[model samples]
Every structure is written in structure tokens, then in C-alpha cells.
Target: MDKAISFEQVTHTYQANTPYAQNALADVSLVIPNNSFTAIIGHTGSGKSTLVQHINALLKPTKGSVQVLGKVITSATTNKNLKAFRQHVGMVFQFPEKQLFEETVIKDIMFGPKNYGVSDADAQQAAKSAMKLVGLDESLAEKSPFDLSGGQMRRVAIAGVLAMKPEILILDEPTAGLDPRGHKEIMDLAQQLHDKDQMTIILVTHQMDDVVNYASQVVVMDEGKIVKTGTAAEIFADPGWVYKMQLNLPSSAEFAQKLVDSGVPIGKLPLTIDQLATKISQLVAEGADTDE
Candidate 1:
């Protein structure tokens, strides 16, 4: 697979040369493959946020370099066409709905494309399509975004980013504050986007279940450095590392581990409910056969 984003020995420092200077990212290097869903997990202040900001050039590294979507961004590099680069990399920050200030939902969704020089007609068409993509009703297009429900408002905000037709989508805690249904809605939408649109997704989240359910690859960050990188199964295969990183396994995995500890014959650690159910059925079948 082609590299969609790459970081080479990247280091970022906040308030450099000041007494309160803090190293947010330290000697970090990573590669995100194209059209892959990668989850970044870590405790607070673990540099997950700081790392994604570099993808769209929101923050520059104090040392080393970051290459995103074929554009190389470095501390000393200047005069680069950041706008054009940003067009291909859409970032949906936490509480994105707070940024929606347009009088109408449709207008808010169209705002991004318009700023990127998309024609009025094209922008409107894109916005309408995006609204549909996010499962928003056409009737609500003219309604005030602030008047909508929290879930609807979030959909509108996400639609705004989708209207830009970015090749790479970066979601920073996309479901930070929402009800259970709202959380499922947002996560399902993300899965649909990745599956249907084949968009490269980089998700920064603390939800281990979301990572297990959606992410093809997982990256664990700690103390401004990447401590581990692997597939979901590989990362969770060893529960000790997860605990050491101050992270917990998905609920399903944890429960499966409990069953294993209780002397149940679980073949492998399961990451999802379905997997766990199947393993349990297998164990029951084996026991029945043995009794015969």
C-alpha cells in the first residue's frame, strides 16, 4: 500500500525557549497507508492531538519532518502551497459543531468548499450530497444549525468537511460528547465512509472498542512517543502491554480474558461480541462431545 502520511523523527515543542516549554511530540516516526483506517490511542497529553495537527499543517514540527499526502512539511520549509495541501486533508476537530456559525445548515456545509474556490453551484451540489451522505434530511437544509439536535448538528459539521471531498480525513475524538445512540450513529457513519468511499481515515480516540471494531491498524502513544504499532489483534494479544501503557482492552476482550482466567477453554482472545459468542459456542460443543 502507498504511504498516505509519513513522519520522520518529528519533534514538536510548545513555547520553545520559554520557562514553560513542553515537548508535545518526541522523535516520532510513523506511516499511515492509503485508504486504511488507523486508530491512535493514548492517555491525555500523549501527543496524539499534536501529531494529527501536522497532517494538515496546523502545527509544524520544531525538528524533523512530516510528509502528508505527498507534501513535505518541515520546520524550515516555507512558501509551500498549504492551502492546496489542506484541501486534500480534511480535519474534523472535537466539537466541530461549535464552529458552525452559518445561518442555515446548507450554507454551513457549503462554507468549506466555497473557501477552497469551489463554484457556488458546485458547492451547493457538494453540500447537498454531503448532507445525504451523513443521513441529514433535505428539509433541514434551510433550518438554523443551532436549532437542530446535538446529533444533527454534529452531522452537519461532518458534512461540511465531507463537502470538501478530501482524500484523507482526520477525526479527533469525533464522538467526544454524545448519547449512546449518537455515538453509534457517528461511528457507523465513519465506518460507512471508510467502506463506501474508501477514504483514508486517521482517528484519534480513547475508545478501545471503536478501535477494535473499526481500525485496521492501531498505534499506541505514550509520553510523546509511539510505544507500539500493530493490527488490533496483535496489539491486544498481549494484555500486559496494554496495561503497561495505561490502557484497557475492549470490553469484549477483557471479558474473554476473564473467561480464560476462570479456566474456560477460549481458543483465542476475542475483540468483538460476535467473536466471543462463537468461541463460547465452540467450547460448549467441545465439552458436549467430550462427555459422549
Candidate 2:
């Protein structure tokens, strides 16, 4: 896969050289492939957030280097296109609803394009496109962002980021604090964006199920360092590493274990609800033949 972002021996501290200079990331290195959906999982202060911020020059590394979109972010030379780089990497934070301070939803969505010097008419066009992409209707354009439901507000904030038409979309706990329905909505929207736009997605979330269902790659971090990185099937096949990292296993992992104990002869250990359901059905059909 093509490399969208690369971190080479990168390290960062909160307050360098001060008494409070706590290390947030330690010699972390990884590559995020282009057009891939990758999830970064870790407990609080595990450096997942710090890692994503480096992709767009939002934060510079205290040591080592970060190369994003083929540009060395920590080079001695300055980036002439730092602004463009930021536009290329759209970041949506946790509880994105908090980003909606504008009076109207349309205005809020247009903020990014407007800041990037797009004309008013073009910005509005971008806003419209973004709204459609995020599953919002034009009727909500004039409504107050503050008055919308939590899920609606979250989508609106995502629209704000989408209006920039970024190549890479980085989300920090995008479904945080949302109910199950709202969480599903946000994730479905992300899946749609990835499917339709072929955009690279880097999701920082604690939701293990999301990793199983959505992410193509899983990157696990602990104590300010990456502990494991692999595909969803590879990582979730065993609960050992997940437990060691102090992270919850996906429900599929648990279900598979139960099936194994029940003598179902389940092989390869599925990692999603659909996979589990299908495997169970197959087992039942096989058992029916054995009884005959």
C-alpha cells in the first residue's frame, strides 16, 4: 500500500525541559497507508491523539521526524504548503458537536473552506456537498447548530471538516459519548465516505467493535509506545495481547471462545457479528446431518 503518513522514531513531550515535561510519545514509528481505514486504540494518555496530530503539522515532534504526504514536517526547512497540508488532513475531534459554535449549520460547515480563501459562493457549494456527504438535508442549513440533536450536531461538525475535501480524515474519538444509535450513524457515515471518496481514514477510538467491523488495520499503543500493529483478524484472534494492553476484546473474540468450548469446531475464529452468525448456522446444519 502507498504510504499516506510516516512517523520515524518520533518522540514528543508535553513540557520539554520543565519539571512537568512528561513524555507523551516515546520513539514511536508507524506508517498509515493511503486509502486505508486504520484505528489507533489505547487508553487515555497513550499517545494516539498525539500521533494523529503530527500528520497535519498540528503538532511538531520534539525528536525524530514525521513525514506526511511526502513532506518532512520536522525538517530544518520550512513547509511552504503547511496550510495546504492541513487542508489535506481534516481532523474531527471527540464530541465534534462542540465545534459547532456558528449560528447556523451552513455557516459552520463553510468555515473551513472560507478560511482557506474560497469564495462565498464556492464555500456554500462546498457546504452543500459536505452536508450531503454526511447525510444532512438542505433544510437543516438554516437551523441553529446548538438546537440540533447530538447526532445531527456531530454530523454537522463532520461536514465542516468534509467541506475542505481532505485526502486524509483523522478522527479522535468521533463516537465518544454517543449512544449506540448515534455511534452507528457516525461510523456508517465514515464508512460511506471511505467507500465513495476513497479517502484515507485514521480513527482514534476505544470502541473495540468498531475496530472489528470497520478498521482494516489496528495499531495498539500502551504507555506512550506502540505495542502491536496488525490486521483486525490477526490482532483479535487472541485476547492475550488485548488484555495485556488493558483494552477490551471485541465481542467476536468472546463469542468465538465460547463456541470453541461448546465443541462447534469453529475454525479461524470470526471477528464480527455477521461472521459469528454465519459460522453458527453452518455448525447447526452440520449437526443436523450428524443426528440423521
Candidate 3:
């Protein structure tokens, strides 16, 4: 697959000359495959957010390089295609309510397309489409965004970014404070975008369940550096790193590991509840046959 974004030996520090200067990212390198769903997981201050901001040129790397849509971010010359680059790589920040300044949700979502020189009618159409993708009703479009509940506001904010019709959507802690239902709703919306639109998604989250179910690739970070990168099964099968990261595995995965440790003859490591049930049923059948 082609790369939508790439980082080469990138390093960044905040307040470079001050005593408060802290290394935010260190020698981080990564390639985000086009049209894939990749999750960046780390505890707070792990550089996951810093690395993602660099993808869309929101943050410049202090050392090494960042390339988005084939354009180098730190090049000496200005990029004439920056607007296009940003249009293709949309970012939905955490607590999007803080960014909602328009009188109505419709106007807020339309802002992006309007700035890109789209006609008013076209921008409205784009706003409606984005609202639908984020599971917002058309009726809410005309209402003031601030009047909505937290979850509604969150989706509205996401719809605003979606209005840009970005090919690569980057989200920073999108589900942070949502209830379980709201969390599932956003995850489903993301999956819909990936499956239907084939949009490359880079999700920065601390939710392991979301990571297990939704991510095609998982990138683990620690103390401003990339610690591990692999598929869900590859990374979750080893509970050591999961423990070290101070993270939890999917419920079924933890159960499966415990059963294996107790010599329960599990066929394989199961990452979901359904898979665990199936494995247990198979184990029971095998024991019955042996008894016969």
C-alpha cells in the first residue's frame, strides 16, 4: 500500500531554550499506510499526540522530517499545496466543543468547505453529508451547537472536519469523555468511513477495547518514543508489553490467557467474547470425546 504519511527520525522538544523544555518526541519514525485504520496508543505525555499533529503539518518537527501526501513539511520553500494537503488530512481535536464558534452546527460544518472556495449551496450539501456520516440528524443542523449535549457536540465537531472530505482523518482522543454508547457510536462511524469511503484513519486513543476491535494496525508509544508497532493479534498476544504499558487487554484475551495458564487446553488466544465462547465449547467437546 502507498503511504499517506511518513516520519523519518523525527524529534521535537517544547520550549527549546527554557528550563521547562521537555522532549515531546524522540527519534520517532513511522509510515501510515494509505486507506488503513491505525491506532496510536499511549498514556498521557507519551508523544502520540505530538506525532499525529506532525502528519498534517499542524506541528513542525524540530529535527529530521515529516512528509504528508508526498510533500515535505520542513522544506525551505513554502508549499503551494498546503491547503490541498490540509484538505486531504483532516484533524478532529479532543473536546471539539471548544472549537465550535459558529451560531449553528450547519454553519460550523460549512466553514471548511466555504474557506476552500466551495459555493454556498455546495458547502451546505457537504455539511449535510458530513452530518449523516457522523450520525447527526439533519434537524440539528440549524440549531446552535452549544445547545447540544456533550456527545452531540462531539459528533457535530467531527462532522465539521468530515465536511472537508479528507482522505486521511486524524483524531486525537475522540472518545475521551463519552459514555459507553457514545463511544461505540463514534467507533462505528469511524468503521463506516473506513469501509465505505476507504479513508485512511489515524486514531489516537487510550481505549484498548476500541483498539482491539477497530484498528488494523496498532502503534504503541512510551516516553516520547515508539515502543511497538504491529497488528492487534500480534501485539495483544503478548501480555507482558500490555502489562508494562499499564494497559488492559480485551476481556476475552485476559480470560484466554488465564485459561491457558491453568492448563485448560484453549485452542488459541481469543480477543473477543464470541471467540472465547467458541473455544470453550470446543474444549468441552474434546473432553467429552476423551471420556467416551
Candidate 4:
């Protein structure tokens, strides 16, 4: 698959040359393929956010380079004419609902496209489409965004990003601070966008279950460096590595490990509940056949 984003030996330092200088990312190299759902998992202060900010040039590398959709950004690169690049890369930060400032939901959603020079009619149409995609009712379009519930406000914020029609959508803890149902809804919406719209999604999250359920690829970060990268199954197959990285296994994997310890004969660690169920059913069938 084509590369949507690439980082070459990228290092970012905050307050460089100062006494309090801190290296947020250290010699990180990665490639995110187009139309793939990638989850970046790490504990707080692990440079996950710093690393992703390079995708759209929100933060330039203190050293090395970053390439997004054919645009190369270096420490010395200028910010001129980056509008085109920004248009193709939409970033939804943590609690994006806090960024919603327009008086009405539709206006809030339309704000992004309008700033990008989309015609008023087209922007309005885009807003409606985005709202639908995020499962927001059209009737709420005219309501004050502040008047909506937390989940609704989050949807409106996400819709605002979707209205831009970005090719690469970077979600930084998009489901943070939401109820369980709202959490599932946001994740489902993300999957819908990935599956139906073919949008490349880069999700930064600490939720192991979300990573197992949604991410096709997983990147583990530690101490400002990528310690592991692989499919979710490959990454979660070894509980030791996860523990060493200061991360926990997805619930299914943890349960499977417990079953294995108790001699249940589960063949491998399962990343999802469905996989665990299948393995348990197979064990049951085998036991019945042996009895017969």
C-alpha cells in the first residue's frame, strides 16, 4: 500500500537550548500506509502526541524529516503554502468538543471548510453530510453547540473535522471523557469512516481494548521511541512485552492467559472477545469428541 505518512529519524525537543529542554521524540521512524487504521499506544508522556503532530506539520522536528502526502517537512521548512497539506490532514484533538465555538452546531461544523475556502453552499452541504456520518440529527443543526450533551458536542466537533474531507484523519483520544455508550459510538463512527469512506485513520489512545478491536496495526511507544510495531495480534501475543512496556493486555487476552494458566488449552492469546469465544467453543467440541 502507498505511504500516507512517513517519519525519518525524527526528533523533537521542547525548549531546545534551555535548561529545561526535554526530548519528546527521539529518532523515531515510521510509515503509516494509506487507508489503514493505526493505533498508537503508550502511557502518558511517551511522545505519542509529539510524534503524531508531525503528520500535518503541527510540530516540526527538531531534527530529521517528516513526509505527509508527498509534502516534506524539516526543521528548517517554512510554513508557507501549507494550507493544501493541512486540508488533506485533519486532526481531532483530545476533548475536541472544547474547540467547538460557533453559536450553532451547523456553523461549528462549517467553520473548517469555510476557512479552507469552500463555497458557502458546499460548506453547508458538507456540514450536513458530516453530521449524518457522526450520527447527529439534522434537527440539531441550529441548536447551540453548548446546549447539547457531552456526547453530542463531541460528535459535532468530529463532524467539523470530517466536513473538511481530509484524506488522513488523526484522532487523539477522540473518545476521552465519555460514557461507555458514547465511547462505543465514537469508536463505531471511526470504524465507519475507515471502512465506508476509506479514510486513513491514525488513532492515539491508551485504551487497549479499543486498539485490539479497531486498529489493524499497533505502534507502541516508550521513552520517546517506538519500542514495537506490528498487527494487534502480533503485539498482544506476548503478555511479557506488554507488561515490560508498562501496558496492559486487552481484556480478551488477559482472560485467555488466565484460562491457559488454568489448563483450558487455549492455543494462543486472543485479542478480541469473538476470538476468545471461538477458541473456547473449539475446546468444548474437542472435549465432547474425546468423551464419545
Candidate 5:
């Protein structure tokens, strides 16, 4: 598969050269495939956030380099040259709704494109299309973003990034602080973007269920180093390692293990509820045949 981003021997140190200097990333090398739904997971302060910031040059690598969507970014890379490259990578930070500042929803969504030198007419058109994509009605265009509910405010914030027409979307705990329903909505939207728009999604999250449900590939990090990278099934097949690293198993995986412990013979460890249900049904049918 084609690669969306590559980090080569990258190291990022905070408060460099000072007594407080700490290595957030150490010799980290990774390649995120183009159009893949990838989840980056680890405990807090495990470099999950630091690794992703390099995707759009938001944080430069103190050593080595990061190449994103064919654009190379090094410690020496200048900001002026990154504007065009950044358009391809849209980042929705945690609590993105806090960033909304324009007087109206339309104006807020239009901010990104306009900042990139797009004209008012074109920017507004993009903004409208983005709003529609996020399931926001065109009628909401006139209302202030703050006037909307927490969920609506979030949708507005996401629409702002969509207006940039990014090829790769980075979500940093996008569903944090949401109620269960709102959590599903955001996850479904991420899935929709990956499916219909063919956008590569880099999701940094702690929710193991979201990882199993939405991400095809999983990257595990610890102590500023990548511990493992594999398909969600491959990663979760053995729950021991995940737990050893202080990571929670997906709800399905945990429940599947309990059923297995009860001698249910759940063949292989499944990553999601739907898969576990199918496995149990297959076992039941086999047992009925044996009874005959």
C-alpha cells in the first residue's frame, strides 16, 4: 500500500538543552499507509500525541525527519513552505469546539480555506459542502457556533477542517468527553469519511472499543517508543500483552475471554461484538448437528 506519512529516526525533545529537557519521542520510525484507518494507542505521556503532531508540521522533529504526503519536513523546514502541504492533512484536536471563534457557523467553517488564500465565494461554497457532509443543515449557517449544543459545536469544528479538503484526517481523541451516543456519532462519521471520501484516518485515542470497531491497523507505543504495529485482530488475539502494557482490551475481547473461561469454546478471540456473536452461533449450530 502507498504510504501517507513516514517518520525516519525521528526524535523530539521538549525543553531541549535545558535541565528540563525530556525526550517525548526517541528514534521513532513509522509509516502510516495511505487510506488506512489507523489507531495509535498507549498510556498517557507515551508519546502518542507527540508522534502525530509531526504529521502536519505542527511539531518539528528535533532529529531526523518526517515526510508527509510527499512533502519533507525537517527541523530546518520553514513555515512558509508548509502551508500548501498542510492543506492535505486536517487535524481535529481534542475539544476542537474550543477553537471556534467566528461570529457565525458559516464564517467559522470558512476560516481555514480563507486563511489558505481562497476567495470568499469559493471558500463559502466549500464551507457549505463541508457543513452538509458533517450532517449539519445549511440553516445552521447563520447561527453562532456557541449557540449550538456540544455535539453541534463539535460538528461545526470538524466541518471547518473538512473545508480544507484534506486527504488525511488526524483525530486526537476526537470523541473525548462525549456521551455514549455522541461518541458513536463521531466514530461513525470517521468511518464514513474513510469509506466514502477515501480519506486516510489517523486516530489517536484511548478507547479500545473504537480501535477494534473502526481501525484496521493499530500502533502501540510506550515510553516514547513503538512497541508493536499490526492488524487489530493480530494485536488483540492475545490480550495478555495489551494488559501488560497498561492498555485495556476492547469490550468484546474482554467479554469473549470470559465466555472462553466458562468453557464456551469461542474458537478465536474476536475483536468486536458482531464477530463474537457470529462465532457463538456457528458453535451452536455445530453442537446441534452433533446431537443429531
Candidate 6:
């Protein structure tokens, strides 16, 4: 698969030249496959947020480079000519609903495209389309964004980014404070974009269940470096390493481990509850047939 984003030995430093100067990223090399649902996971201060910020040049590498959509961003790369390139990468920051400040839902959603030089008519149409894509009702277009529920506000914020029609979407802990339903809704929206729109998705999250359920690729980070990159199953295969990294196992995986310890004969660990149930059922059926 083609790469939607590539980081070559990238390092980002904050507060350079001061006592607080710290490396948020260190010698990071990664390639995110085009149209893939990739998740970056780690404990607090593990550089998950710092990593995704590079996709849209929100934080340029202090050393090395980031190539996204064929545009290279380095420390020397200036924003003067980044408009076209940046337009292709949309970032939905943590608490994106907090970014919504427009008087109406449609207006908030239209801001991004309009700022990108789209005409009002075209921007409005894009906003409407994006709203529908994010599961927002057309009737809410004229409603003040502040009047919406937290989940609806978040959808409006995401619709705003979707209006720009980015080729790659970077979500920084998109489900941070949402309720169970909201979390699933946002995740489903991301899957739809990846599957139907062929959009590359890079998500930074602490939710292991979300990683197991949604992410096709997982990157584990620590301190300021990329520790490992593999499928979710591969990442979770070694429970010892996962715990050593201070990362929580997905709930289903934890339960499966207990069953395995009890001599359940589980060959492969199940990452989700549904997978665990299916495996147990199959084992039960096999045992019943043997007894018969």
C-alpha cells in the first residue's frame, strides 16, 4: 500500500534553548499506509499527541522530516507555502467541541472550507454534506452550535474538518470525554471515512478497546520514541510487555488471559468480548461433540 504519511528520523523539541526544552519526539521513523486505520497508543506523556501533530505540520520536526501527501515538512519548512499541502490533512484536536465558536452549526462547519478559499455556496454545500456524513441532522444547521449536546457539538466540530474534504484525518484522542454511545459513534464515523471515502486515519488514543476494535495498525510509543509498530493482535500478543509499558490490556484480552490460565486451551488471545465469546462457544461445541 502507498504511504499517506512518513516520518524519517523525526525529532521535535519544545521550548528550545530554555531550561524547559524537551524532546517531544526522538528519532521517530514511521509510515502510515494510505487509507489505513492506524492508532498511536501510549501512557501519558508518551508522545502520542506530539506524533499526530506532525501530520498537518502543526508541529514540525526539529530534526529530520515528515512527508505527507507528497509534501515534505522540516524544521526549516515555512507555513508561507503550506496552504495547499495542509488542506489535505485535517486535524481534530482533543476536545474539538471546545473549538466550536460559530453562531450556528452550518456556519461552524463551513468555516474551514471557506477559509481555504472555497466559495460561500460551495462551502455551505460541503458543510451540509459533511454534517450528514457525521450524522448531524440538516435541521440543526441553523441551530447555535452551543445549544447542541456534547456529542452533537463534537460532531459539528468534526463536520467542520470533514467539510474541508481532507485526504488524511488526524484525530487526537477524539473520544476523550465522551459517553459510551458517543465514543462508538465517533469511532464508527472514522471507520466509515476510511472504508467509504478511502481516507487515511491516524488516531491518538489511550483506549485499548478502541485500538482492538477499530485500528488495523498500532504504533506503541514511550518516552519520546516509537517503541513498536504492528497489527493490534501483534501488539497485544505479549501481555508481559504490554504491562511493563504501563499500558492496560483490552478488557476482553484480560478476561481471556484468566481463562487461559485456568486451562481453557485458548491458542490465540481474543482482543474483544465478541471474539472471546465466539472462541469459547466453538470450544464448548467441540467438547460436546467429543462427549457424544
lDDT of 3 by residue, 1-292 (tens): 6998888998888887799998899998998898999999887888888889888877788788988778888734265767777888899888877899999999999999999999999999999999988889899988999999899999888988999999899988898889998888888999999999999999998777788899999999999999999998888877877888877888888888898889887755898778888888888898999999
User: What tens-digit string does per-residue lDDT give for candidate 5 at 1-292?
Assistant: 6998999999999999999999999999999999999999999999999999999899999999998888888889999988888899999999999999999999999999999999999999999999999999999999999999899999999999999999999999999999998899989999999999999999999999999899988999999999999988888877888898899989888988898889888778887889878888898899999999
Off by over 4 Å in 6: 286-292
TM-score for each model: 0.96, 0.93, 0.91, 0.95, 0.95, 0.95
Query: Which 10 successive residues of model 3 have the least lDDT summed?
Result: 74-83
How many clashes in each structure?
0, 0, 0, 0, 0, 0
Residue 102, candidate 5: C-alpha displacement in angstroms: 1.6
Quote the positional error of residue 174 for candidate 6 in Å: 1.0
Instruction: Show the lowest summed lDDT stretch of 10 residues, model 1.
Output: 76-85
The predicted structure with the larger lDDT, 2 or 6, is 6
**Residue 120 of model 2, lDDT score:** 98
Error of 4 at 97 (Å): 0.8
Residue-wise lDDT of candidate 2 within 110-200, one digit each (tens)? 9999999999999999999999999899999999999889889999999999999999999899998888999999999889888889999
Q: lDDT of each model, Cα atoms only?
A: 0.94, 0.89, 0.88, 0.93, 0.94, 0.93
Error of 2 at 237 (Å): 1.7
- Candidate 3: residue 96 lDDT (0-100): 76
Residue 263, model 5: lDDT of 88
lDDT (tens digit, per residue) of candidate 1 on 147-175: 99999999999999999999999999999
